[model samples]
Structure formats: structure tokens, C-alpha cells
Target: MENLEKAIAEIKQALPGLTLLEQEPLAAHCSFRIGGPARALAVPQDVSSLARICSILKEHQLAPFLLGNGTNILFPDEGLQELFLISTEKLQKLFLLPDGAIYAEAGVSLSRLASFAQQNGLQGLEFASGIPGSVGGGVFINAGAYGGELKDVIESVVCLYAPDQGLYELSKEQCAFSYRKSYFSTHGGCMILSAVFRLQPGDREEIAAKMRELNEKRRAKQPLELPSAGSTFKRPEGHFAGALIEQAGLKGFTVGGAQVSEKHAGFVVNVGGATSHDVYDLMLHVRKTVYENSGVVLEPEVIILAPDYKLEDKGPRVHGNIVTVNGPAEE
Candidate 1:
């Protein structure tokens, strides 16, 4: 407790202007709307401010979690007492380059990016129109939908590598994007600052039409009305996770307020007042049941976090008829 207080005090002293929220409720930040209060949360206004905050956290040996819009993560019900959260939501900046590319900060929402692309008459970003995450989170998990992905249009990414506290630019290839995976997944220390997306000139009307079409599809299939992380499981190899769950007779399955959406088996929605433990237990049940029904193991796509949480064994754990696959699925 003393160390935590010291760290918080030092952070405020170093970055006087940085926005600080003490004992901030994390549920207010995440899309799932389920989580306890965080010890301290920092919202950096810009990239330079984010860098300074990161440096200070590092100097204090405090490893903060970098949050981007919080659309695809699950915060523990017990809350994060030790880890300070740094939200990039305020770092939003977007513009079109004269050469027909879009430059966006990590905090820029995918929706905004898609709109910006349409405004500039740029194509190739229509697929991300309804994605609820910020650009940084999108690139982190190589977010994709409607047959388009960040890897398809990204030219380069500006990252703040935490090891040296230095900024570096990585080309699209260097991003190591592959099937909802990226270099950021393995290297948790690096922070994405901004990205330059290479897009082609196209008809604005056509782009709008495409976005509308995709959004309609999303609305029809997804349980958008409920509070839930977008997709609960990654598309398993050669099989869709949703289909597998449906086949396993797990649709509409409930564990407290958390339930596998009958509207979309791929999603686990919080009906009302769901706790993080509810969601986590439901995920474990889904994975185990799906694995038992079919030989294939299902892995969670939602980024789950708690201060003392540790990755369990990846191999199947047999308990009665349920077989749990503890490995991470593709984002």
C-alpha cells in the first residue's frame, strides 16, 4: 500500500498536467461494463504525454496496462489494485496525407478511421467501419471483420518500445500481422503510438454503401444491444468458434448474468450486473463443453486481466466430461 501510494504520488509530481483518476471504476471504461475500481487510472492527452507517463511508470518499476477504448478486454471483478491503467482514449488524432494515406493515432476509433477514409474518398477501410476498438487495439490484435484487416492497409506503425523508452517505426511487414495476431501480442512492453494506412482512391458513395451493408449484417447477427466483448472466441483453425458452440448446444447458456448470446453464439453477453468472474466461468464452461463435444479446443479471444492472474496450462485439463483448453486463441 505504501509503495502504491508512493508510485501514485511520484506520477502526479512528474506529470502535473496528466489526467489522473483515483480509484476509478473500470466498468466505466470497458465495453463489458463489469469490473471493480482501479487504484489509479491515467488518461494521457497526447503521444508526448503518454511517453512521459510511461517513462515515469517505468522509473517507479510500475508496469501499467495500456488500454485503448476497452472494447475487447475483460477486467477482473476484484479490480486491479496493483497495476495502474493508462488509457489512450484521449490521444485521438486523425488526418489524411496528401498522398492519399490516412494517419491516425492509437486512440482513434475504428469507426472514426473508417469515416475519415470515406470522407477522403479512400477505400480498403470499409471492413473496419463498425469495429468498436481504437486503432491501437485494432492493430494490437490485427482486428478484422467483413473480409478486411489492418494488415491489408497498414503502411507503418509508430511504437514506443518500453525496453529503451524510445520511439521506433515498424513497417507493415515488421508488424508481423497474421490471422488476428501481431508482434504486440508477444511483446507486451511496446506501446503503439500511431499508424499510417495506405489506401486507394475510391468512390465515397461506394465506400459508404459497403460500410452500411456490413453494419447491417453486424446488427442482424450480433447482440449489439447487450454489454459484451465483441467475439468471445477466436475462429479456430478450419472451423468457426460460434458454429462449434452452437453445435455443442451451448447457445443461450448462462452463468449468472453472463450468457452465450442466443442472438450470436460467438458472443457472451452480460444480461445485467454480470461480474468478471461470471464471464470467466462461462468462458471456461464453453471451452470445456465445446472441446468435449468436438475434439477441437476453443480458446478465448477476449483479453482477460487481473493483477495476480497467471496463464494456466495449455494442455487439456479433464474434469469429469469437461475438458478445458487453457491456451489462448487467436484474436
Candidate 2:
């Protein structure tokens, strides 16, 4: 406790405008609303502040986790310890360039980007209308949805990296984007500052109509009424996670407060007061039962940031291009 407080104080001196909170609840930040309190959390007001805070944490050997919209993570019940949570919620800056390009800051949400594109008569980004995450997080995980992915529109990304010194620009090809992966994820030391996307001119009404169509589909098919970390697992080769769960007859399966969504068998929703352990246990059960029943194994799509009660069976994750993972397009 004393160490965390001292860290917070030191961070405040380094970053004046940024706000620091001790023992901040992770559940409040996550969409699932399941995680326990973090040791400390810092919300930087802008890019400069964020960089400064990062530098401070690194200097103190207290490297923290970068938290975005919290749409794709499940924190543990015992909570994170001796770690700092840095939020970019306040760094939202969206603008249109004179060269028909859209420059968006990392903190901007996909939903916001979709709206901006539609309003400006931009044809692309229609598939990302309902993706609930920030640009950095989306790009970090290569978020995609409705047949469109981030690599489709992203021309280049400007990142704050300290390989030599300060931030630098990396082209689309340099990003090394792949199926739900990126260079920033592979090679550390790069913090996404912003991105420039090339968009085609189109009718505003047409773009709006497309956005509405996708949003409607998401509402109808997904369990929007419940809280979940999007899809529970990635689509394995020649198989779908939802279908596997359904075939296993584990739809609506419950573990404590966590229950698989009957609306969409792929999702494990928090019906009421679900704990992190409950969700983790249920996920493990789904993987075990599905593998036992069938030859295929399921891999988790949602990232876990805390310790689990038991270790997940570690083996080769089923990988191939036999299926598509539906998600919001990346920036």
C-alpha cells in the first residue's frame, strides 16, 4: 500500500495534469463489470502526459498495463497487484485532413470513428459501427467486424517508440498486421499515438444506411442486453466456437454468476453478479467438454490479465484460414 502511494505521488510530480487514483476498481472500467480493484490507476489528459507517465513508470521499474475501453479483457477476482493502469480515455482527437485522410488519436472510440466517417460521407468504416473499443486497443489487437478489418483502411500509424529516441512513423506494411495481431504486440516499446486512414468519398446517406444495417444486425444476433467480453474464443480452423459450444449442449451453461449466452452461444455473459473466476471456470469447462466431445480445441479470444484458479490446458492452438472472426475494423 505504501509503495503504491509513493508511486502515485511520484507519478503526479512527473505528470501535473494527469489524475491518479489508488485502489481503483477495474470492474468499473471493464464492460463485463467483473474485475476487482487495481493497485493504482492513472488517467493522462493528453499524449504528452501519457508519455511522461510511461517514462516515469519505466524509470521506477513499475511498468503498467495500458487499458483502453475494456471491452475484451477479463480481470481476476483477487485483483491486480503492484501494477498501474494507464487509461487513454481523455486523448480523443479526431480530425479530417485536406488530402481525404482521417487522422484519429489512439483514444478515439471505433463507434465515434464510424460516426465521423458516415457524417463526412466516407464510404469505409461501416463495419465498425458497433465495435466498443479505442483506436489504440483496436489496432493493438487488430480488431475487425462484419468482413472488414483495420488493415483495410489504415494507411500508416504514428507511434511513440523509444528504440532510438522519441516517436516515429511506421507504414502499414511495417506494422506487420495479421489475423488479430500486430508489430506493437510482437515487438514492444511502441505506444500508438495516432493513425491516418485513407477513406473514399461516398454519399452520406448511403454510409449511414450501411452503419444502421450493421448495428441492427449486431443488436439482433448478439446478447447486447447482457455483459460479456465480446466473443469468448477465437474461431478454430474448419470450426466455429459458437457451434462447438452448441454441439456440446453447453449453451446457457452456468458457473456461479457466469452463464453462456443462449442468444449467442459464443459469448459467456454475466447474467447478474458474475465474478472473474466464474467466467474463467466456465470458459475452461467449455474448452474441455468441447475437446472431449469432438476432436477440435477452442482458443480464447478475450485476453485475461490476472491469475486464474487453475491453468488452461496448454497445447498447440488450432490455426488456419478456414473460418473468419467477425469483429470491428481496426483504425
Per-residue lDDT of candidate 1, residues 223-316 (tens digit): 9999998998888899999999999999999999999999999999999999987887788888888998998887667787743443355234
Please, what are the lDDT tens digits per residue for candidate 2 over residues 48-127?
A: 88787767655555545667899988887777766677887887999999898999998899999989988888988998
The CA lDDT of each predicted structure is 0.84, 0.80
Per-candidate count of clashing residue pairs (backbone under 3 Å): 0, 5
Q: Could you estimate the TM-score for every candidate? A: 0.93, 0.90
Candidate 2 global Cα RMSD: 5.0
Q: Which stretches of candidate 1 lie over 4 Å from their true place?
A: 1-3, 309-331
Highest lDDT against the true fold, candidate: 1
